[model samples]
Target: MENFIYKITPSKLNGTVNVSGAKNSALRLLAASILTDRDVTLENNPNELLDVKIHVEMLEALGKNISIEADRILIKDESFNNELVWNKRSIRNTVLIAGALFARSGYASVPLPGGCQLGDRKIDIHLDIFEKFGAKINFETGETNDTLMLTKETELVGQDIHLPIRSTGATENSILIGSLAKGTTRIFNPHVRPEVLDLLDLVSKMGAKVEVFGQDYIQITGIGGQSTPITPIVHEVVPDNVEAITWLMMAIVNKSKMEIKNFPYAHLVVPMQFLLEGNSGISFDEASQTLSVDGKNATSFEIATGPYPGINSDMHPIFAAYGTFAMSNSVVTELRFFDRFQYLEEMAKLGANIVQDKNTITISGNIKVKSETVRATDLRGGMAVLMLLNEGTDTATITEAFQIERGYNNFVTKFNALGGKLEKVFPESTKEINVTKEALVA
Candidate 1:
């Protein structure tokens, strides 16, 4: 299907939704597994997302045996082909494999990856910093797909590598290489997101010594066990904080009582603190690892998004949608991703008074948005549109819903279970665009 057309009406969700496993965590773990021949079993993995699917296929092509279900994955990489056919469209996660592939077989070849348009997600940092540890790379930009071939001259020696910016992909590549390199490797200015922390923990179980000093520095002591056998351990993937925050918005905007299970509140303390400061009606039960939100005292709030342990740039749109119906103005400053407000125009269709200036967005609250046809441009932005639809007056249609499905698993089913008025209208089931155009002309 090209996209999903969501037919929605004004409704409040009063039930619960179990968030999916973190796509980020699962993919990185998959990459790190290449360093070992031991079987790796990951529980609570999010296999539904499109990105995860692509990575699974890529790993299979590398001669890894993978068995996947809805929430569990068992993978064993005893041997892999040195040559890999490349697809640029979903290159983001595959870039991490360079280090692990080199560690296992001393050779790595894959096409350059080109993924979503979230700015500054380049692989140059991964390539440049990996070279510091003795990985040789040849790059030639091609018209159809840029081919990248990587080989190791010798075993990677432990060294200190500094990143100008804390890019997540670069940090992960360094960790994968450090796990198999000689001596201790220190990474400066690493992006210490929860997913990264989970990856470090997983590798530690696999006999890689890893340490974190504060949020900016990560130290990993290499096993230096090239061609040596490794004992893999069972690891459960971390819960998805982004997905948790999305469902939290659902509970509040629908003005309903909801409970979210398996919520890792520590990883999400920063954004959750913002909601608390803003008087969002939510509370946590640490004993049970659940968050309870009622439809009471949903207040207006302002937040500034930064790196991890701070407000995430992904949370910008979800909160923008929630604050639109608040009692006052909710000002958002997106310091990380500037062009995240593309969905504001579609939001305005719901009678939301949202003003955008450069990287800042100011949303006027207490106004009831209209139920009208709008578009979901990106993953996070598409979710924001869904929250806006709940606060709308009547019916609404959300276009390009595949963007939402990219991250959310069982979106329509979960939303409907929570008393949400949502349905996916397939293009085949609905009127064809070409036929509709012809009818208009006639």
Candidate 2:
């Protein structure tokens, strides 16, 4: 909608909510499914969000037969020979597809990918690894047509590659290609998101030699082809840390308490520890995978967003929302997504005292939100606005909510179920609401 309002009423969130599958892991695993020529079934998968649906469509275009029922995806025609083609407009999942196509057909050519406008997420690391595995990449500088050609030696010959940074996407790409390469591929300075490990686990189950060496290294020995068809396996997607954090921040900002069920404790350790540092009372029971946040009087603290096991970049916007009601200043330094501070402007519209620099957001505590229309800059940013709106501000009109729909399935519905008053107002209807002087006077 051009402009839409969510009329949230202040309410206590006391019940439990189960977390869905990890979107990050599912994207990689879905790409990895193309590695086999047999029927590959992924269990514990979450609902098909926009990115997943787009990836599936891209695969289907490349001649992969796919079927979805419930939380499972059955991918047959594992003999992935055709080039994975996609609309030049849809490049969000291209990197993941690159790994899968490289593993399956020994070559892949697709346009450069797209996603959040978080500055240059250089594919240098990915391309460097692919080149080390002997793939020729040709980038058309002026044009959108980019090509990656894999040769006879296209099969990745496993070798020790050290990463300068611990990028999750690069690490997963390396693992996927390494699984089908000729020798053992050892990656150092790698990211160990449990979701990435889950994909490795799946590849290992498919007769690949994959192992996690402590927290920094992953070793994978090449297995040339799928030994057998992937049997339908039940894989419960890990709970989304960002989602849990969003709800938790909402609870705190609203001066309400909530018990989040299926909360991924391990994945959220860093953020939870940070929240606790901010004086937000939180209790966790690992056995039940539940986290309870009693945020009746939550304070604010500084946070630096980092990679996994650190304050994640994805959780920064939610943290920003929580900062609005904190008793003290909250400094959020986004170390990963340097340019993600654009959301601060939207937060400012809600009367949040926020200032942005190159990579840091200095948030002054104690904001009194005013009803205003704001636009979602990105996925997490959209969720942040939604969380802030839940505290019953006069009325908040948010645009670009479609960005939220990209990652979250029926988000407004879920929030509504929790007593949030939000209605999906289309742009056409909003056009008729011209503020007249008489209406304002009344």
Candidate 3:
């Protein structure tokens, strides 16, 4: 409920947990599903996130036969409309859909993308790359939302394009369209985040030819020049690297003995380096694939968020929370999203001495949270408070729990499995907490 608040008391979490399917990967895969006329089943995809639901609702609006059986999403064969009719006015994935729609139907009308508003994730690169492939791009402001129409009267032929930045979104959009476009499309300076690799694998399984050059170049050969039919696919999403990192943070911040199973170590090579930062309490079991930590002491850390393989921009708020209890100073420079550190202000409510010197966040001193209530401004920012709550010496209330729910699947249950004592309080309910609260105690 909108009026509900989460009361999370400080506790230690210890258990093995599986990260949900990559939301980023699933969003792009959902968009890529439109490139096919055959049934597309995505295994391990979570259907509950608000962004995913919004994208699915948009697909259903365009006559996509979508159904869910447990964690697998069955998208039956259906004719897609030429117009990009989205239920939500804006989602960052819309730019992605525009690319897929243009390739599949030769026309796409999408509202300017909006989702997880950290900063201006510009679509200029998207439009520029599409234009390189001879797409006719136009912008018109509408009453409800400003629409970006990408119409290709002729077939989309592959082109070699160099991206100034290795953007995951831009790369995904390019790959989606390029997979269906006539001829070969070569993307230079592409982001090869594990999630992007997952998309490449998904498309390759669905009949496209993709080649990776080290890490930055992705060469895609379209499926028989748009004449070939898309083969139906059954693909599992890549494990969420961020979620794995969250559990790692949980291990350190809570300072509890914990085992995090299904930890994606390969994708986290760069991030893991920073998190470890010569810390002795955490160790990895390569054979068993577990990250275990005993919270005997806090490890000092400093990091700067960049593109993929670098620390993710989304991790800034989370690590900021972890920085609170570190034995020494931790500095984070968020290069991707300018406004990402805004959540740090809220964490200060818990007595985190986080100071922003321009884009870099300087966090000093170990803190015991005195925060009673705080707001979750954005998706990841919202989760930051929960990390802060885990450090609460007393009970703390985190408002806007929906933001966390949007991205995370079974948030409370997973945390509870790790020994977290959290409860949802509904102001509108006649009872303090709904009957569902009994499930925890039971």
Candidate 4:
């Protein structure tokens, strides 16, 4: 198999761009599909994402019938397969898949979850949740891969699960398992994120009685042992707030004008406040569902990431890129993931001067970075590099370009639609291709 790379040329963004469906929300919906036996239809799904594609394959391996028509996905399962003999790489959503299967048949065997090297994302919390739900958990370690097995000797009994921390996966799994448990399950100290809310919206449409009382707790009344004959549902996914911010930052850094459609104004209250406070040229028209930016006032600012309704840890990299184009210095403190500085080294390849002291990073802006070969260590980190490269007037290669595809959907076409220059290049030999700046911009 030939591995391809992304070759980016200096280009300016203009015109309108539509936001795709949320990757985080869609994956959870796919896993939650198994909670009911009826066919579930999801609209506005970003099926182009590599992670979603891999998860679709995983669902098929478990005996679900999946059909993709344009941006919509229809999932149907006539007969459930509790065990998954997966041969391909698995995603972190497999944990949710286990919970759904346990709710269906009381037993599930799935390959261990695999995802980006984002610090220590342990599954101990998930195991604890399952154990609290009256299920026995075991880990079968193999030479090449490991498998997580869950079994229940009796019906799952609902109980109060108080999360030690605001972990998203643990909270989502609680809802999945609680939907079919014998009684009502209440989750205290849950991470009430937008994606979590989306999942709640989905399962509710499929006949799960879920109620939210602020951020304090969530209660789900299960359908008991009779898990079948669930109401078939059609739902539309929420827009990707992360991608919306990505386009906003990219247009501002490149000094371009862009109008973002399908904009989820409600989900971006905090991040947009920060941008407006920093004097970034931005305006939103709620009636039209459009956000327009001229990118004339891009400047340095300060920010710290936290949980939902705040700047996410994933948004830090791009915000760092946004600060990199300013005439003054910018500071960012990552309070969520302290060890996410692996992308800093790769950013330096493009002349980014970032100093790190523990979880805080000070980015010295006003430096013009030259085009150079860089690697995409993770999904968000890779997109940050692409935005930085777009701010330049030369050609650069991004090795391991597939990392970007895990989140952003149809990025190449969308970039070109906004007058940004990007090309997918497959190497014929070991030598790299060089293009003149004038030729690239022409």
Model 3 whole-model lDDT (C-alpha atoms): 0.78
Tens-place lDDT per residue, model 2, 307-375, is 778887888888888887888888888888677776778887777888787788788887777667788
Each candidate: how many clashes?
A: 3, 3, 2, 0
How displaced is residue 383 in candidate 3, in Å? 1.4
Model 3: worst 10 consecutive residues (lDDT sum): 433-442
| TM-score to native of every candidate shown | 0.91, 0.89, 0.91, 0.94
Give lDDT tens digits, candidate 1, residues 1-442. 1445788887878876787788778889988888787899999988877667768788888889999877888898756786678533444666777777877677888766644456555577888876887778897765555667888887678889898887777888888888877889999999999889999998787777898997768999888864544555689988888999888876766778999988889888878776776545688989989899886645688789888888878788888988886888989999977766778888887788988888888889887777788887777888888787777778878886766776776778888898888888887644333211111110
Model 1 error, position 185 (Å): 0.6
How much lDDT does each candidate structure score? 0.78, 0.71, 0.78, 0.85
Residue 346's lDDT in candidate 2: 84
Give me the displacement of residue 282 in model 4, in angstroms: 1.4
Candidate 3 lDDT, 1-442, residue by residue in tens: 1346788888878777777888888999999888888888999897777678878888887679889876789987577686765433356788888888888878888876776656556678999988887789999866545678987866678888898987888888889988887789999999888889889998887788999996668899988454555556889987778788887887777778887776789888987887776567788888987778775655668888988778888788878877777878888888877866657777777787887888998888577778568877777888888887777778888876766776786678888887889997776652232212111110
- Worst 10-residue lDDT window for candidate 2 reads 433-442
lDDT of 2: 0.71
- Candidate 3 regions exceeding 4 Å error are 1-4, 87-89, 224-231, 425-442
Q: Considering only N, C-alpha and C atoms within 3 Å, which residue pairs clash in candidate 2?
A: 37-78, 43-235, 44-235
